[model samples]
Target: MPATRALVLAAAVICLAAAGWLVLREATDPGLAAHPVPGMGEMNAAELSRDGYLVIPAMLREVYVAFGATEEAVIHDTLAAVAAGPALETLYLDRAGAMAGGGLDGADQEIHEMELLDLASSRDGAMLSVNATWRVLGTVGHAEHMHVRGNVYSAALTLAPTAAGWRITGFELLDVDRSDAGTMVAAPEPAEATGG
Candidate 1:
């Protein structure tokens, strides 16, 4: 009976240790603590703060909406409104032009979910990373009609305070996972990759 009691005590200790390890892992995960952007909700720019959590996500959403638009004027206006510095030039000159030239101008995309993965900020500048899932519901680059429900992208962005407000200065797309019919497809090889 004493041996049986010892075995039970050991089992309980192991279970407790496992539970403690899980708790610690969760506590240390940055994604678990990051803020989730409300889907398709309007964020008041006046309420945005440099040190607060809302600014990065809001600006990212604006960029997303602008890229999804079919009208060049809308894309130009939205990017101009929300971005400045290098980000503005890159988006307008490089990315938007690429989209039009690649036949992505007619595609319709919308971000259905977004998660802030990390953030760091100072008095004058800020940097953040985010993961967003967009629903793609139109043809892409002259391909047949496609509907991708889980097109996930990871991006890093930088922002600075300007007289007009917080303006995004940098944007880099890090990774992409394009989906087909709601199923996650394998990421393409580096040479074949096209990012958002």
Candidate 2:
């Protein structure tokens, strides 16, 4: 009888410890912005924030995947690959739109490497703000390319949540021009240009 009681107590303690570990991990690790269950999108910002601040990461991840995946080399023969990963998407992003400019094309990392440092994100009502430092390093048309770095770029975007949690619908990139600036050499200047 005593053995049975001890076994039950050990099991309960182990279960409790595991649960506590999961909660702590989720609170600290900014990477897993996953909403395993469908969020009740009917709630307002305050309500959503109450349930672990899920909106910001979800919206940001979508943007990262969308933007990072598309890359075409410029006049230079150099290649740039952008991927949507923890380095840029899940963790390491800031309220100022700060994130690493990763050249990750799905699983394929681009030859032309670009990284965004000190990335941040902010939300004003339905509008989400992204700011980050831009750095470009790799080969241009030549073999060595040009080792260059620039300041942070700011972007103000409007985000919306569908049944699939939060995703960016309409966004206004105030200073940065996505068409031409999204490149290796002739890309947008840095945070200063965008007033980030």
Which candidate number would show the highest TM-score if scored against the true structure? 1
Candidate 2 C-alpha lDDT tens digits along 1-196: 9999999999999999999998887566533333322333354433444442344434433343333333332201111111122222322232112213443333221224344444456555533344433433332222223223232334443333334444443444335423333344543345743889
Model 1 residue 133 CA deviation in Å: 11
TM-score of each: 0.51, 0.30
- The TM-score of candidate 1 is 0.51
Off by over 4 Å in 2: 1-43, 47-58, 70-151, 177-196
In the range 1-196, model 1's lDDT, one tens digit per residue, is 9999999999999999999987886576422222322332332222233333655666666777787777778888888777888888888776567675776746445456666655544332123333333333322323433343645555556654444555666777676666443633444555664552
Q: State the lDDT at 172 in candidate 2.
A: 42
lDDT for residue 30 in candidate 1, whole number 0-100 = 29
